[model samples]
Target: MDRSSDAPPHPAQALPVPAWQGTWRFTLPPIDSSVPQARHAIRDLLRRRAAPLSAERTHGLMLILSELVTNAVRHAALLTPEIGVEVTVDPHWAWVRVEDGHPYRPHALAASPERQRTGGRGLLLVQATAQEAGGSCGVRATAGGGKVIWAVLPLDRPTGRPATSPPPRSAP
Candidate 1:
């Protein structure tokens, strides 16, 4: 009697995970130069990983990244020796977080046409940008007595494939 008929079939191979479906964290010196460097690094990372974000989404993410890093460098440099940046991109959303040793959790100011201002609008801009893209932004106090400001944007496109828009967002 042939015994080969009793053998089970081989299991199917699993699909390879995407390169961009994970978190990337790094620290940069709290200095003016780090602002542009952080932006370039993020742009390159998205390009290199072939993230599924549209061009406009990528640009907006970069802008949010820039403002966060710039704020850390300008305000937190006195107490923070290094600024930390973390980028997390899953299938549904892209998240950027900036952490600094300073404990201040800066609040985003509401834009007032009556009040003229040049500076102090970074957080406001970040909030507006994230909101426009169906995302949310907020600040949290870290365990080490620092603060982390984060923003997340949904990666849902209007066409081509099924939209996996993020769940309802909470207040920023």
Candidate 2:
């Protein structure tokens, strides 16, 4: 019998799940100080995610987002009046992607005698934070002659000793 051809397809070939299921987008004017704005936007988005994130994780996410936005602003050529930063967060991961209007490919600067003085530490910072949070970072060229710098942070809550309770108060 030729019944094998009529069998249902395997489910293992289905598309993989997205790391971040919820998405938020922001548009900021092309300016030198857009990093701070990006950080604030990320903070607000993280708050909306309703995760019990520690201060260290929150700070790390903000710093990494700011660095990525700053790198895009400084390196990419601006065509439109605004640049966009897209943030995506899910229960297991968070990511920040910055889009600019330049066609340059993002590259990590190698440590060298001459290159070190050019102030190219932003990418390093992003990479470091991502690794620390058990995640990764990368970049890709956009379709409209632009580039996107992205960094992902794992949302895995730390597992170890229980959190310490506040000390007892003495009677007044």
Candidate 3:
């Protein structure tokens, strides 16, 4: 997605222009504190703007943002002293991106039962959460030689159901 409010609306929704329809950006020094700060700020911005996202969607987005910022702090702090965060929402979708000046592009590890570890699975969780919510995520190289990890999700639930409800059951 373009991460701009001007992006086209989803075909099914004819939503009116929301108060939160715009792109917002932030730059923070890569540090442990920046993780929560970034998440909180984004949360507050969305709430203050009265974003149409459901609580579940907002929470999922926050988790993705936290993981991205925490990764940047842990892995890229030395090379990239600053981290960039961006949030954008239109009537149909919401986008979150975290950028750092590291050249390495990390991939989400595949989920498995045998792998026993407490850490190094942030990206995997990010991918799974996004996919479950009918969204997509990936990394892209920035013009400055850095990488931006991003996720884009719909403003409304994709399954035509409430966000907190389970996906419809399949017939036997």
Candidate 4:
């Protein structure tokens, strides 16, 4: 039997999404390996749309997507089937939404050095990244019983972590 046909794709070969301007959505099998693929997909989506992200923001997006997708994979099963990742962008912001097969919860513990060593800092980092980009993080229960955790990042925010968007370019 040809085993190549049965193997999962290498991370770089994970997706070839059509170029889209406003939004791109993906449904990946709920497995651990999907995490990196998800990150690459989002990065490709941003680049294909001609949206330039600061290096800091790029790093933030990778961390947030990895954390969110890893959490969803933990809760996935036959009943769940798939996990959804959505990337949407507008003139001023880029938003990432991950839909999981679980319900939303409001409470989260503050992350500390000790706690982080044990691997519980996902949401803490996510929320911090959102705020750092002049945006917000939120969670809500979907009508179908799953949960969606999202972060909205400002597109115009400075790459150097400055307090405001770059000044508008003056007309030539």
Better of 3 and 4 by lDDT: 3
How many clashing residue pairs are found in candidate 2? Answer: 0
lDDT of each residue in 1-172, candidate 1, tens digit only: 9987687755664465688778999999999999999999999999899888899999989999999999999999998989999999877788999999999889987768986887899999998999898888888888999989999988754323544554444412
Question: After superposition on all CA atoms, how large is the RMSD of candidate 1?
Answer: 4.7
Which segments of candidate 1 are over 4 A away from where they belong?
Answer: 1-12, 156-172
RMSD of each: 4.7, 12.8, 9.8, 15.6
Clashing residue pairs, backbone N/CA/C < 3 A, model 3: none
Q: Find the candidate with the highest lDDT and give its number.
A: 1
Candidate 2 residue 148 C-alpha distance from true site, Å: 1.1
Distance from true location, Cα of 146 in model 3, Å: 0.9
Q: Where does candidate 3 have its weakest 10-residue lDDT segment?
A: 163-172
- Model 4 earns a TM-score of 0.73
Best by TM-score: 1
Candidate 2 residue lDDT tens string, 81-137: 568888776555566788888777666666767664757877877877877776678
Question: Which rank order by lDDT, best down to worst?
Answer: 1, 3, 4, 2
Model 4 alpha-carbon drift over 4 Å, by segment: 1-21, 76-79, 104-106, 112-117, 157-172
In order, what lDDT does every prediction score? 0.86, 0.70, 0.84, 0.72
lDDT of 4 by residue, 18-123 (tens): 2333777889988888999999988877766667577788778778888888878875444467899998765556778888776655344586666646665678
For every model shown, the clashing-pair count is 0, 0, 0, 0
Q: How far is 92's C-alpha from truth in model 4 (Å)?
A: 0.6
